[model samples]
Target: SQKIEQNSEALNIQEGKTATLTCNYTNYSPAYLQWYRQDPGRGPVFLLLIRENEKEKRKERLKVTFDTTLKQSLFHITASQPADSATYLCALVSGLYGGATNKLIFGTGTLLAVQP
Candidate 1:
């Protein structure tokens, strides 16, 4: 079993600027690191997915980095917009249920508020 730290702080940033959010974990090694965006009362929308073997991954204005040794992953959004405001969730694969299956452990999530 692993513990996922919750970052309850809200991140406020100006539109057109870059917003960087961090995810830290302890007690388990995840096979893959994933990021998601969730709006109030809605399910999370998948964002970035990085493998443990990969150091970094990028798509358009979104980028993510995984450092297994540091037990952390970073999520970045370039030229952020007010529409990007939402709660960001950090998730990783776990075997808490056992049997070589992938179950995800999600963090409490950090809220990002992009102001125009």
Candidate 2:
């Protein structure tokens, strides 16, 4: 069995600053990790995905790092603005329960609030 967890609390930061969120996992070795952003009443939008062998991945102002050795992943947003305020989630394919379907299991998610 594998479990995923993200910061349960909301993060407050000033606009134009950087926001960093963490994702931790236990009891499984996933082939990759993914990050997504979700607004209230909306489904999560895919942000980035990093393979276990990849150290880092970047897209626009977003960067994601996956460290299999530590069973953790980090998601970063640079030059963040108030529009960036939303809930961020980390998801991974469950190796134990996901046999051939490769089901995705998501973390609790972390709320980010960028204040101007």
Candidate 3:
């Protein structure tokens, strides 16, 4: 089994501020890391993906960075709002070089609460 660590407590942020979350894994190496947003009672929605070879990737209002050396990934959301309040998860495919045979493992997830 794969285990990744995220913030055990919910992160509270003010509206229009930038919220950053961290994911760290101690066991396995991943070819890529992905970020997702999940609302209560809803499936996770894909947000970003950063490969091991890539340093960073960004989407509107969101940015993700992957650091293979540190076995960590950081997710950032700028100008965050109440709508951005949700559980953010980090995931990766467990295999050498992320082949199709690899299974995806998701981190425990960190909840972000944006206050307006």
Best candidate, TM-score: 2
Residue ranges of candidate 1 with Cα displaced over 4 Å: 96-100
Candidate 3: residue pairs that collide = none
lDDT of 2 by residue, 54-92 (tens): 999999999999999899999999999999999999999
What is the C-alpha local distance difference test score of each model? 0.92, 0.94, 0.91
Q: What is the TM-score of each candidate against the true structure?
A: 0.92, 0.94, 0.93
**What is the per-residue lDDT of model 1 for residues 1-116, given as tens digits with 9 covering 90 to 100?**
57776478999999999999999999988888899999999999999899999999999999999999999999999999999999999999877546677878899999999999
**Can you write out model 3's per-residue Cα lDDT over 1-116, one digit (the tens) per residue?**
55788997999999999999999988877888899899999999988989899999999999999999998999999999999999999999877663568677888899999999
The candidates, ranked best first by lDDT, are: 2, 1, 3
Residue 101 displacement in candidate 3 (angstroms): 3.1
Candidate 1 has an lDDT of 0.92
Scored by Cα lDDT, where does model 3 land?
Answer: 0.91
Worst 10 residues of 1 by lDDT: 94-103
Between prediction 2 and prediction 3, which has the larger lDDT? 2
lDDT of 2 at 43: 100
